[model samples]
Target: MKESTGQTIMIQGEQTGILDADTVLITGNVSVPAGGTLTFLPGTTILTTGFFGINVEGTLLAEGTINSKLVFSVADTSGFYNLYDSRGGWNGINFLSTDQAGDSSIFSHCTFYYGKAFGDSINKMGGALNIRNFSKIRISDCEFKHNKAIFWGGAVFAEESDLKITNTEFSDNFCGTPGPPYGYGGAACFRYSDADLTGCRFYGNSSTGIGGAVSCEYSDVLITTGVFQDNFSGLGGALGYLRSNPDRPVSCNLFTGNSSLFFGGAISCNRANPSFINNTITENHSVSYGGGFYCNDSAAPVLINTILYGNYAPEGQQVYIWDVNSSPSFYYCNVQGDSAAFGGTGGIGFNSPYLYNTDTLPLFSGIYPSPFTLSDNSPCINAGNPDTTGLMLPETDLAGNIRIVGNVIDQGCYENQSGLTATGRVNKELQILCYPNPFRENVTFILPGEYHGNCSINITDMSGKMVFSSSSMKGNSFNWNVVTDKTTGLNPGFYCVSISAGKVNGSALILHVE
Candidate 1:
């Protein structure tokens, strides 16, 4: 491997044909020239032999289709592309420095797999990249599997950059230090940056300290229609946020399912105040407190039309809002769980949750596999705020479906309908759903198609009471607020959500409150 100090290299510009080499290696550090394009033809496989691989400084636009997918992996003297052999070798590719002006670098339809690491810092670098300070960067249709980083970010470590990520799958990435002061993240880590992630799936990863799936620190992230399941971390199981700043802590975008350790088993926000609306946070367990959420000394999270079910810890469980100064508010929010009530604690296991509305009990009656179904006559059906804005809801869910329908707002990320199934399921069909049932606190619903037009969604409670609602819907989702009391009002009962168009027919639902 020859070393090059310069930062400009042109690969196949006026030249075409396949540049097939035994090892397409980068010696020292190489960068593409300004406004230059490096194109990789079909059936192009590049191999490197350094601590780091090809580092792109300028713009990189590598587009590969299904049949002729681009591959970035290790090389042996025997010319074998071993998938499971990580005998302390090398990183696949590295993109260090990017162009300042016109910072729109994109990587699409690529597969980064089977990278490894050893100790401290970052051992085997990026499976595909490690970028910094770039704008409008897009990575889509990519698969990062069986990649390992010693410290953080299994597939990619994007820092101090504004990026848009979509349709990416990160699986089987491990980042766990067994000894003292352990730290690791199975997936990506965002620090001091702004990013929007959509249609991404994070599953089957393990970490030691925090954030097995994703970690956000001192940054603003918006996640829409993403799935986080079966990921494990010591502190925050699926997602973790550790922001030092009191006023402007790191905030992650809305949508659902972030299981954690002490607080927010599905999603945990330590000192952050990210908007959380219309998400399903369930089935998360904590060893001590906050089966679903554990907040302390932080700003009160704004929850609208979201569902919290089957989340459990020990003793005092569910949402534990302790030491948080700001009073948190929940409008048409549903919290359903079971309590064994040890040590004469009683039936309720939820600790003190800062309330805007005082209905803190689970509204419906039933058990898992079918708890808050509309057919079961659950109170969560239509209990929502009628005054939520379009800015609160997402443009679409993970499968690119719209979020709002008629004037009705469904609960959680996926709209509950009579017959709808979750993504990545074998029998993609639902048995029961919830809609326009009578809401009191908040209303949640799913959209029909991709929401591309402007719309508004609202909510109200029983006895013709209007509590929360909103307009300015920019996308397909909606979370209507109906909580009237900021501190301690709202008797446990039922609620409703009403949706509308530009002078068109509306819809409604009834929700059960406990």
Candidate 2:
């Protein structure tokens, strides 16, 4: 099954059905044989020649949805030019093989611009594309502009691979190639592989010497719902995690950002213990060390509910959790600017770690006499950590509802919940008023009256079985003895009567039968 010379071969180089060539004009160096299924409809346009354009190995179903798209630019047939003049022109899709493992290949809703990378190094121009080693790729909602991987992954160069990127976009990828010892990730470069990024977005990339956007060694990433902006890495504008062995545990996968970088800008866990959650790291910019984050030495990162605003490395400010053995811990967090560090590099607390609820976590609403302005009752408003029930929350923010009740789940990535209202916050309204509302079995639980005394009456049966539980039900009233028939008989449905009284806990609405 090897016959794909170029210039057009839909069913000719087929493996199944309809792929009648929407535009397959690969002018040089081509080879896509191995049970291929390369489909590219929806306003299609494919043209490659700078060096190595589309070389899949087999099974490449170029998917396109979200409003017609599957363009791989670079052939204007003169027509007066100017698609940005066709930029560098080649190197944006290469899934080679020496038997590089298996897994359905797909490049969804495609869009890669001015591609060029494959030699002078940067892994090849910004390393436009070269994912060897046991491939299993799936790049989603793609978009990479001004491609340049002179070496690295200005676009992508994953080795020993198994990648899955979503909602993609890696901006201004640069790095003119320089590895060996010079620096790291000008845009993206990983070794000893295992990547899994989600909801991706890395902006304004730049890496003169070190990871301007990303560079992971002994790799292991699992980033989620992303946004790494204004990237610049002399060290780690957005990422730079390295690890040889300290018990060997270098693993990344989570980082939160809303307004993105200016320095170690959004992340720099140079030792690795990655698992940062809920991000909205703001206003980044560096001067000396880390402007937004810079966890060094024994990198320990497990920060949950993140939000650090107005970041700046003003003469060495913000973060610099150095000295290894790093035990970075912060729950339901939110830290404001100005982390002192003059002749005495000490900002955001150097050593002596272990801190909890930092002043209940930035809960200020007023404190600006001169230029200290912090108007709208600051305390970062509504403060976060609604206790985070079972964790894993983020269904919709960035303006998409369903995040949490009252829309109050702020700490980053936006979720103001608009006109949020909970009024008389406490008083849970008699803990949620319910006087046997619709009860049957000799029901009685009227504890509102400002609720008092000993109480603990549970009667769950919505599958949460616990048919009944009583604890000396004293005060307001409590009585339920409809044992229905010894051990099983009542067949009426709906049942949940949780009553706590003392620290207030209420729930009622029952129905029983026999």
Candidate 3:
């Protein structure tokens, strides 16, 4: 592979051909003109020295392997944050409308960082990627981080396009201005488009206007099997939708720890009636109103087989409707405090039937990554719509388990596979005893009396992050001193301990105190 130094174009002879170099340092902008195709090979790196980017009018194919990922970033990151004017850093990839003959652009296993969108009207959005004018594209296994946009879409903005993003991760991206019309989509904004997003995760993305994670307007967007965590914004802490109605709907996802200063701790809708099915909305907060959902301007969302718990707001702890034009209905959901929990005429109330909605306490596993998984004794089991024929259900649940485990679908994103093996074989739950339940520095785990030889012990925090692991412990009784084992210093929180001995696979929750 060749390496270029301060060159305007690395492959000047073939501007619309392959780029297979170890590193290419660019000092000026590069464009793949109409009727052209550009491909970046695996392990290729394009570093911009100043404000520059790749303009694609035809096609861009960046196919990188898992071991050799493709990178597009700035060469010098010094004073990167000092230039907060939103005009700093290299300009991102811009894909204009192309009527030329070519396949859809494909980007896989790529990392984009420190891209910025500024200057003119067309350049004021999509810090990392801008797709427009009926373009079709697919992005998978891509990571977008620490990018900024002046108006909308800190990482990506799509307009009048067909976009499909799979298994992509967005983190620490920001978008907005100081004015009242701040911005939209801290990580992504879609307008007049049809998008399919599956297995995507957004974390710590922020925007001042709406949609800390994503904002969709007049777009039929489908979001399935993803997580939106700790995102912040003015309207929707995680998502803001405007006049979006997809046939598939958003399902089997987790939304938690998101906050909004205005409305909709988890989601905000304006003239949008998106379907939310089998999702878990929890631990979200709104300083104004609508802890879980906020609706206005004829927005009437239908939620089925969902759970709303531990959300907080002044007026509505679970949901709030701002106007009579907006009406939200819930069916077979475990809503905390019930319809009376929310404040608004259009929300669930006594005038309308419960729709089989329950106020029962949803017994959750409380595990991290998936906090609202149903416990074995949870009342939400087998309590879904019963007839899921037209629901357009995914083949597998959020955890990759069978969508419907028992006689019916579960009430949340995760299907209860407790006591069931991979092949759908029935298994018995083993008993494990932890003494001195909430300990400060020491704890003991004892297995069942039937049989105990060697055991493997795994301890994970509430978020399912592994903290300690032990293997081949030759006894039924195992004593662990948290202070002595410097590696296993336990924190003050809830943790789950799993023990595997023979056919025994059992887990129990333990607490640590300061």
Candidate 4:
């Protein structure tokens, strides 16, 4: 150990006690022995060279203030222009312990960047931070970016650990070696662990396989008020869960603009059962199936008050299920397509025995980071499951608004604070007039004076089958000339004419004579 007042000190071997306002340069691997504690003060910068890493078997406390942050960066940038060139620049910090209650590590207001963990072909795991063997760790207000791992987690990897990560941001991280299941998570990966992530943001991450942002196997994860956006992978662009507990839920989260090559543009579950609540999954594209969500091999995910829309795929644009054993449940969700798009032989739709879902349009404000705000006349407002017996709901929405604006909760991650009831319409008092009660020539529709804007008219039979539809109505009135249909002519019958102008919808009955 070489200590200097203002210059860099080469640190190796066992380090204990306090390191305040120091610039430590690591050229070789360092370790903290058992019962030892290494504490860093604010404004401390540790630059590593020669693939050096800090291994801790005791405790590490790196607590920095908002104004002063602890930075972990590479010492050499001679050939480092991109992630590939910076590979093996420095190994990351590793915490190893078998005692669950004894291990305690905390990192706050820290920045970890340009770390590369390419642990031989066998144990390639975390790129920036690794917690192994029942270690308990807490990370808060940290930033992890530009990290690369040859396999597994690009930023963090936890095995059999209990981790709590809050107010963190992970971006531009990557994992994989260009093939197969070797690449798991671009930001973080967990195995047989318990993780709780709150108020975190993961963006612009990519993986060659599995989860682009996060992946879990045999783990219990509860993610709340998190944002995952613009992540890419072969499966599960935002999150992938395998054999995870169903009771461990992901609530009040936003997943948008994620893309996958095979399945689950936003989320994928394989042999896993997890609950998703109050999540906005939109604008994600899948090349094969399940643009918004995917389930296979007995994966059963319960979706409650979630919004899935504007996703694109060849089949199951909103949700896709491959195995017949996979039974996904939907409650008070706003899905994109009809029952056919929800896959599986099980019942699907609003009236289906297994679903309280709807195909109503969820008018999102825009893409990711846009809050997914509901319009004033959106049907999703106040349309949520009334029973909140055992559900875990966040106290506030993504925008920090009250989760429930009115009596009932709103669907999706955002709750509108407009205080508008579900029964409120755009124009409740607008009147609709239909002329020619019993005519064979033509019929005309007139709108109220207060109504202005383009309106659509649809004539449906008594059996709820739409026979005639017109959107060309202009200036409040439209004349429909009854013409003989080339296939089936209009017979003497009663029909309902529904007119929609702005946010107001009204219907009028008309009669046709032979």
Candidate 5:
């Protein structure tokens, strides 16, 4: 283990390695010039002071083990210096590219915190790490926290780069200074870049402008199995997409508890059309529009087997589309409301061929880390569109379950397999059958002939209110008129029908439509 305690060290046109358990004190900047390679072994710590940082024009590899991790932080621990206070004390690592297609820099099992990037009028980005000009980088199993940027990308900023990040966490980072268009990407920002992010988590990040968690502009990105929670911004509490490529997709993600001051509490898209599949967007709040999603300027996103529920906004509690060209397509989704949930110029066509969509309660098991897990008796079970021939879908659900259990798939992010056996068969016999489920005015229920006793029928709405009831009816078949006890008609929505005969009780879901 080598210990290098210096005010400033410069490595030019050479290869260097920091061994395990090495402690380096960087009072000034460390520059790795062209044709240089710098590597850090496990248990290496670089303590910086003042505006100290590393400038790399070559390659860097900092790989650490689970027990021994690499840490980068400010060296000053003086009086009255909190984590947020140490934001501007030191700059962060900057990777500049002299070659367009070369070996990539890699960082794994690392922790970065309390770094700040306050660029001058010309250049400002990446509080912790910056990649520029066709640089290729890969980061995995890392944590970035408490970083701040004066302009954009509080944690990482990449421009025209190729980046792959997985199994990482970005938390408590902030960007911008209470202004418009300046603050973007509280965690990371990508411009004209290609990035693939999977199995990551973003939490408690804030931006003054847009994209509290991530902002992608003119970029091609594929994000899967990510969780975004409690992020805040002016728009796009979790993600902001601007002029991005429509070919790439974002699938199997969970967005929950995020808040926005203006638009799109969960996601905002402008002039970008991306495919979203099997994601759960819930409990997001927007002060203006689109508690779940917002689209403008010909942004036509494709949503498949997604869930949008429990979001709150004055206009478009689930989705908001500004213009007719910005018409999003929804297929096999479980939204919280009906056509009113889609606000703006385009109306009911926002949902395509509503064969398997429901405004009923999704009956989620929980709403925290995994927000859209299906309850045992959820209506979303086996209710998704089974024609997944060309759509982009993950092999497994958010909980790592098989994407399709039976011949049919479940809606939302989870595929429930509670009642089925290993071969996907029910252990018990069928209790009741209901035909013409989504009926206009009436629905018929059929019971087994063996149960010839008096039966009681009860129908309840989504709020668990008993809308219709019939007592002491002896018959094998019964039809409900879809009316309340006061002789008023029920609205178009979903309702639960419960039946009791002798000692047997059964329940089924039915939809009422106009």
Candidate 6:
């Protein structure tokens, strides 16, 4: 070890202990022995000169702050694109099966870039963070970018380990080679492991194989409130869930703008029965089938209060099943097409036994720039299951709003705080006009001055249960404060109101109250 005047150290062999300086260079293989710990201070930088790796058979604690992040990278990868092996430089931390003290290991507010994995079959995995055996690890608030692996995970690979990652960002990572099952998971892969990811974002990652961003096989994973966008692959454009399903369902996520060369523009489920709830899948493209999702080999994903729209494919615009063994079920969802529009083998059909789903425009604020907030006239508001008992939804949606704002959860990822019910734009054909259509406490009904005091006003809930019934007192304009007036037993929801005042036009109006 050679220490410079500025406290920068150069390590040519194994290393351990605390690295509190601003710069540390690894010129050769480095290993932290078992029962040992390698700690990095805030703003510490670890730079690898060759294809060397920082082998961690013990524990690594890199706890940096938001203002001071620990960085692991190569010094220069200037002309790396011309050479396949040099594109992604340096070997990342190899948490081998021999590791024992890694269970309590934590890495937070760190940045990993330009990591690569390629050699024998055993070494060609996990470009950035590789783990094996029964060890458990926690990685939070980390950024991984421009990493590559010949097989398995481009940024991270884990087998038989419990990996908990939260609030991380993965971008521009890729699988170096595209092939069969081996070349998968452009960003991350897990096999026979148990993992939990929360509030993660994956975009601009790709593989010529299965998952463009993430792939899992024989692993149980619970991912909540994730965002996957603009990734592409041959099969699953964003995620490939293969033979993996955790106890808790993957909920309140957003999958958008992903494309596939073949099937499942957003997600592909193969022999995996993952439960998805309150997710928004939209604007994905597939050349053949299942623009939003593709399921095969006994895969049956249960969807609740999910929204799928604007997906493009030649056959199944939203979803496609390879055969009858796979049947995706939707409950209280907002789908753009009906059952007849779903496609599969031999004229097979999709199964969605629940009711109260709208098959029209959800009226989003916009398609891109995230959030995709709901407009006032959107039918998705208050469109979820009335009872939020066993739903197991996240407390917050993608936009950080309360998941269930009104009587029920919103249909998509965003909860509209403004409107709680679906009431289309008021009709001009009706002579009777109401101000503050989605009123909080009260609303005013204005007649055309031709109705009498006996004008009938009836209000019923969506289930056709009469909630309020009254006649016009004596004026052309009647203001009713439903909250204060005990005579009006009004509840918050969509109400169908019919007014018959002589011949003032016979029409039913849809009104909403919050």
Report the poorest 10 consecutive residues by lDDT, candidate 6: 505-514
Instruction: List runs of model 3 lying over 4 Å from the truth.
Output: 1-14, 82-87, 345-353, 419-514
What are the clashing pairs of model 4? none
- The stretch of ten residues in a row with the least summed lDDT in candidate 3 is 419-428
The total number of steric clashes, by the backbone 3 Å criterion, in model 5 comes to 0
Q: Rate residue 316 of model 2 by lDDT.
A: 41
Question: 1-514 in candidate 3: lDDT tens per residue?
Answer: 2222322335322267776567766677878777788887777787888778888877888888788888888887665564255334778989865654666888998999999887787987898998887456899999999888888999999998878999999999988887855889999999998898899999999999999999999988888988998999999999999887766688988888798999999899989988899998877878889988888888877899998876777778678888877777789888987888776666644344369887655556766556678777566778788888777778888888898976688888889987332222113455567787556788898876765688899888768788888996677888877877674556665567777887756676565667
Error of 1 at 158 (Å): 1.6
Point to the candidate with the largest lDDT: 3
Q: How many backbone clashes does candidate 3 have?
A: 2
For candidate 1, which ten residues in a row score worst on lDDT? 424-433
Better TM-score candidate (3, 5): 3
Per-prediction backbone clash count: 71, 35, 2, 0, 0, 0
lDDT for each residue of candidate 6 in 1-514, tens digit (9 for 90 to 100) = 2221246887856667887678988888888777788888878788988888888777778888888888999877664443256443888888875465444778999999988876777677888888888456899999999888888788998898878999999998888464454468889988987888899999899887888999888888878889998898888999998986656777888898798988899999998888788888887878788889888888877878888876767788788878887777778888766656677871255554636666765556543355357766566788888887877788898888788776767888888888446654422223556676546677777877655556777766545566677775466766767766663546544455556665443333334434
> What TM-score, over all chains together, does every model reach?
0.64, 0.35, 0.80, 0.80, 0.77, 0.79
Give the C-alpha miss distance for residue 319 in model 1, angstroms: 2.1
Clashing pairs in 5: none
lDDT order of candidates, top first = 3, 4, 6, 5, 2, 1
Candidate 5 residue spans exceeding 4 A from truth:
1-15, 19-21, 77-87, 347-355, 367-371, 419-514
Write one digit per residue (lDDT tens) for candidate 4, span 1-514: 2222355567877898877547978878888777788887777888887778888888888888788788887887455324444444577888765234455788999999877876565336788897787556889999999887878898998988778999999998888876555589899999988889889999998888889999999999888999999998889999999887746689999998798999899999999989999999986878788888988887878889998876766677788887767877788988866556675333233223347777765644333245367766667888889776677887898888899887888899999889988675533524566676545768888998766678888887645677888787788888887764321477655566778887667665465656
Write one digit per residue (lDDT tens) for candidate 2, span 421-467: 43333334233333443334565666756455778887765455677
Error of 2 at 308 (Å): 4.9
**CA lDDT of each prediction against the hidden true structure:** 0.53, 0.55, 0.80, 0.78, 0.76, 0.76
RMSD of each: 15.1, 18.1, 7.7, 10.9, 9.1, 12.3
Looking at model 1, residue 199 earns an lDDT score of 75
Estimate candidate 5's alpha-carbon lDDT, on a 0 to 1 scale. 0.76
